[model samples]
Structures are given as structure tokens and as C-alpha cells.
Target: MCVEEQWLTPQGIVIGTLLGIVLHVRFSPDDQQVAVCAGNKIYMLSAKNEAILAELDGHLAPVTAAEFCTWEKSMLISVSEDRTFKARKL
Candidate 1:
């Protein structure tokens, strides 16, 4: 994905990939990082280069949704079909 500023110059900011089936993705309020969920795991990546910063795994079933906490930039919430919700700090 590329991050671009809406201005006269339409230069794109190229970012790498997480290399998997991405189920969901959300960006933090600061816009410096992003949370990605794939299969049963969640990963935090740099929004600038898409580098993997952290990986979290706990759910037994496939993940359904992933969201970032507005109040906490380092906190992420995820829900799975295993009938469980997880709160993790990235």
C-alpha cells in the first residue's frame, strides 16, 4: 500500500506487505502504525514501510474482526469465531 498526501504533488509513499491473507486492518490515531489480522494472528506494522513490529497469537479459531483503541495507541482488540475477544498491547 502507498500513503499519499492530497496535494499538488501526488508522490506515493511505498510500503511493504505482511505476506498473508489479511482479514482486517486498522490504523492508530497517530497514523504511525497499523494493526493487521490474518488467520488467527494479529500483527503490528510500521505504516511507513510495512515492517512487522509485533505479532500476537492466542485465538483458537479464525479471527472475525480487529480494531484499534482510540484512547490507547498501543492497545488492540480482536474477536474470533471461537467465541472469544482478545485485548492486546502492541
Candidate 2:
């Protein structure tokens, strides 16, 4: 979902548990979703309920960072210890 500008204050924070080491967590541009970088995969999670939406697995090594593109609300980028940068649209 592409949101032009986010003006509303988030109602609450999302809290949950995840397996393995979590490298990074990035909120979607619209603040309705979350992308978690853990180990070799990116976990797409729901911001409202903290539920696992999907798992993005492509890197062969541990992921170092993940973020949502500010300009492209549906785009996500992840970097890995294997020296590769991946971009995906959610």
C-alpha cells in the first residue's frame, strides 16, 4: 500500500516473539506492516496484531538489515552478511 504522507500518531506499539537472532526491524511506509530481518530471512509481519504474514527467504547468509523504502511504500530492501543487497515489493 502506498501512503503519501503519514500524519497520524501510532496508536500503540507492536510486541511479539520471534525465533533466532533478530537483526533489524523496519516499519512499512504506511505504518501498517513490519519487516523483520532475522537470520537468513525477512519476516513480514502485521503491525496491528503482530502476526507473521510471510517469510522472505533468499539470502544464503544472515541478514544484516531491512528497511522499507520511503519513496516506494511497497518496496523493501535487505542486506546480508553474504554481501548482497536484495529489493522486494510486498
Candidate 3:
């Protein structure tokens, strides 16, 4: 979704809550990125800046879990309330 928005704390630390009500979060295999599941979509974010990089929309219900593929950092696996599981390429 490319939120391009940042949330700053009083101490000047930035925490990204852009995805809104994130149900799950997992680091990439290399720990260089993060995958977040919010609503029915999955958001790919930069680990360093928490910048949204891509949005994947395929689930019909709220996503319940998300994890990066162990062998492929660009591949993400997700489960949803829709009773389905899916994989997306980042």
C-alpha cells in the first residue's frame, strides 16, 4: 500500500503500525524484511525503516498468520479466517 507514513514516539523511535491491527508478523529468512498480516492483506515492510514495500491482497477474510519462506525470503505464506492458505511472492 505504500503508506509513506511514519509514527514517531516521544523518544524519537519510529514504530510502524501502518498495516492497522496486525494479526501476525515475521521476519524474513535473512532478517532484512518483515511481513505483516492485517485485515485480508499482507504488507511487506522494510526491517530498517518499517516502510511498506508491497501489499498482497488475496484472502477473502482477515489474515491470521504470516511467515516468510525458510528457503525463499521473497516468498510468504499466510493463513486467513477464510479457511484458506496462500503464498505470495514479495
How much lDDT does each candidate structure score?
0.79, 0.84, 0.80
lDDT of 1 by residue, 23-59 (tens): 7888788888877778888777889884888878999
lDDT of 3 by residue, 1-90 (tens): 233433232335243665689888887888777788889988887878858888889899999999778787678889999999998777
Residue 86 in candidate 3 has what lDDT? 94
In model 3, where do residues sit more than 4 Å from their true spots? 1-15
**TM-score for predicted model 3 compared with the true structure:** 0.78
Candidate 2 backbone collisions, by pair: none
- Candidates 1 and 3 compared: the better one by TM-score is 3
Model 2 weakest 10-residue run by lDDT: 1-10
- TM per candidate comes to 0.75, 0.78, 0.78
| Candidate closer to the true structure by lDDT (higher is better), 1 or 3 | 3
Please state the error at residue 41 of candidate 3 in Å. Answer: 1.1
Error of 3 at 83 (Å): 0.6
Clashing pairs in 3: none
**Residue-wise lDDT of candidate 2 within 15-65, one digit each (tens)?**
447457998888887878888888999888888896888899999999989
The number of residue pairs in model 1 that clash at the backbone is 0
